[model samples]
Structure formats: structure tokens, C-alpha cells
Target: MKGLTDRQQEILDLIKSNLENNGLPPTRADIARTLGFKSPNAAEQHLRAIEKKGFISILAGASRGIILNTEEALGIPVIGLVAAGGPILAQENIEKRIPQAHNILSNKIDYYLRVKGDSMVDVGIYENDLIGVNKKNPIKVGSIVIARIGEEVTVKTLESISSNQVVLKAENSEYSNIEINPEKDEIVFEGTCVGLLRDFS
Candidate 1:
């Protein structure tokens, strides 16, 4: 916390909270959106400043690679597939609460969603992985998001948003991108993916 600017301290705290709760570090895009930094580059710059202050370590070529020097424990709810006509965070949908102490990063996580398919495997989100979700962050293009189309829910990257349609792309080539006309289709954004958790056990 020493030698870091106020914003840097805030980002560091977010990194700590994310690590404790989700067991993974937050991506630059996750930090940027949560703190309203306009772009992930701004978050990366702040992360560099925090790293210089000796609070966190940033690893290149990894999205959730920020490492904290200390440890803390916290629990976040893990949601399974959404139940019919129920809210995503409904008690019935919660599979379990996961607690972790690892080098995870991100902003405040609302819950961890248990992935059910291989559509996002190319981005490292595979079936049965638990992805951290933050409902408060602003959704943006290129951000991976948990979306609901009517009664079905899926995770995909937000490719583009136009005045007429929104495009969601799957990370795997086996799946086609989904395009929705806002005026004619019902699309609900549950939350944006901030981090991921995989259980080897």
C-alpha cells in the first residue's frame, strides 16, 4: 500500500479481494471496467505503478496473472445452470460456495458461474470451469459476458454492439457467433466474466 497513488491502492485492494474470493487474478480489462478506466491499457498502467510499489506482480501473456504478496480467505457463490423462470442468482441455482487463497485478481465478484459447454474453450474457459462474474461493471465490446437469451444462458465474448444488433462470439470455431436484434429479441446480460477457477480435484 505504501508509495502507491490513491487509485493504485484501490486497484491493489481490488486485486486482493478478487484473489481471496475467486482464487484468480483479474485481467486488465476486468480492472479497467470495474474502476471506469475507459480501457484496459489504463488499468495496465496502474498495475505497473502498483507493481513498482511492490504490492502486486503482473505476468505477461496471462490474462488472470496478477499475483499478491499476501494471502486472505473469502467465499463466493458458484452458480450452476439457471433454473427455468428463476433469477440467475437464485438460491436454487447456487451449487456451492468456493473459498480460495491464491494469486487471483479482479474487482468485486458477485458469484462464480459453473460453465456447462465448450464454446469458450479457446479462451481457456472450458466446460465445468467456474468463472467469476461481476454484475456491476459496464459491459463493453470484446469483454466476455454471461448472457441470457430468454430462458437459455450462455457465455460468449461481446464482439460488437450496434444501434440495431449485438453480436456475441464463441471462442471455438465449432460454434457460430450469435447475433441479436435488440428491438425484436430479448437479451439479458447477467454479468461480465472477470476471472476463472478450475478444480483439479
Candidate 2:
């Protein structure tokens, strides 16, 4: 890949490192504050230069919209919430970042999130476990994921028992399975879980 100028690369490094460590890109003000610039506009100038050089993409009109152009995009999709009555990824209530890997995550997806529920305890994912996800799908069987049903979010293991029915199974018995018919209900698969992380420290 083409290399960036020293200052440009330094700026890029800051943004990339922030996303890697914090699970979200930094805002212009954040970049300026970190680099000790006189104003956020100074950081913005550097970012625009980086974007012009094809090192990153800036989501206009949105705060903290920077995205890395490298493999990090495939690293994880943050689990935000569990769908109603389901045990997996729920779109409506998503709240955190989950880290997975490229091979397991779908392309051009969003960040990962931390899971919160005992429904999936049997699968080794306790409350506060991180789950990765992809935005694109034809989600496969046995994939852990986030789903959206009506207005709630939940986490669960996904199971495809038939051509028309999709099942979301909880890892623990304290929860029940959520079955949906794609042809009738408004249930939607938000993303697939691709990675896991535990904070033991």
C-alpha cells in the first residue's frame, strides 16, 4: 500500500488506534484534543487530507464517523441489543462493541458489542460477553447473532430447522426459544456474532 506522510500517518495511527482500543472512531474534536492542536478544525484539516489520500473515509455530518480503510473493518460488529424474546443480536437495543475477526465477520459491517443476559450462559457467553457481527447476510445455521423483532433486542444462538422457520435458542434453560416465519412476522436478523472477549482484569 502507498505510505502516508509522517504527520498524515501519525493522524491515521491515532484514529485507527482509538477504534481498536475504544471500539469507535474518534471525533474531530477528539483528534484535535489528543494531538494538542489549537482547534478541532486543525484536526479536521489533517483528516480531510488523509481522506483525499485514500487512507480513510469521513462520514459527513456525523460525529466520530471516521472509518479505517484496512482490515479492521472486518474485525467485529458490536452487539447493541437482544431482540424481543430472542437470544441474539437485536437492532433496536444495541449498546456496545464486540470484537470478532475478518473471516467470521461479513464485509463492510459495523462494530461489535458486549452481550448482557444469562440466556446464553450455556454457550460460554455470560452477561457482558462481546459478539461480532456483519451487516450483510443469508445468516447460516449455528451462527450466534443479533435479531430485531418489533421493538426489543436480545441475544441467542441461531438455528435453522426448516426452509421457512428460523429459531433463536437461548444457551440456558431460564430462557425460551423464539421461532419466526419469515413470510409472516416482522422479525429481522441484525447481524452474526463473530468473536468473543472477556474482561478478567
Task: Return the top candidate by lDDT.
Answer: 1
What is each predicted model's overall lDDT from 0 to 1? 0.85, 0.71
Q: How do all models score by TM-score?
A: 0.62, 0.50
**TM-score of model 1 vs. true structure:** 0.62
Which prediction has the highest TM-score against the true structure?
1
Model 2, C-alpha of 196: deviation from truth (Å): 0.7
Over 4 Å off, model 2:
1-109, 161-163
Scored against the true structure, residue 164 in model 2 reaches a CA lDDT of: 74
lDDT of 2 by residue, 48-115 (tens): 88888777888999888887775454433354544447444445544543344445434545655677
Model 1 lDDT per residue over 148-193, tens place: 9988989999999987899999999999999999889889998899
Error of 2 at 68 (Å): 7.2
Candidate 2: worst-modelled 10 consecutive residues by lDDT: 97-106
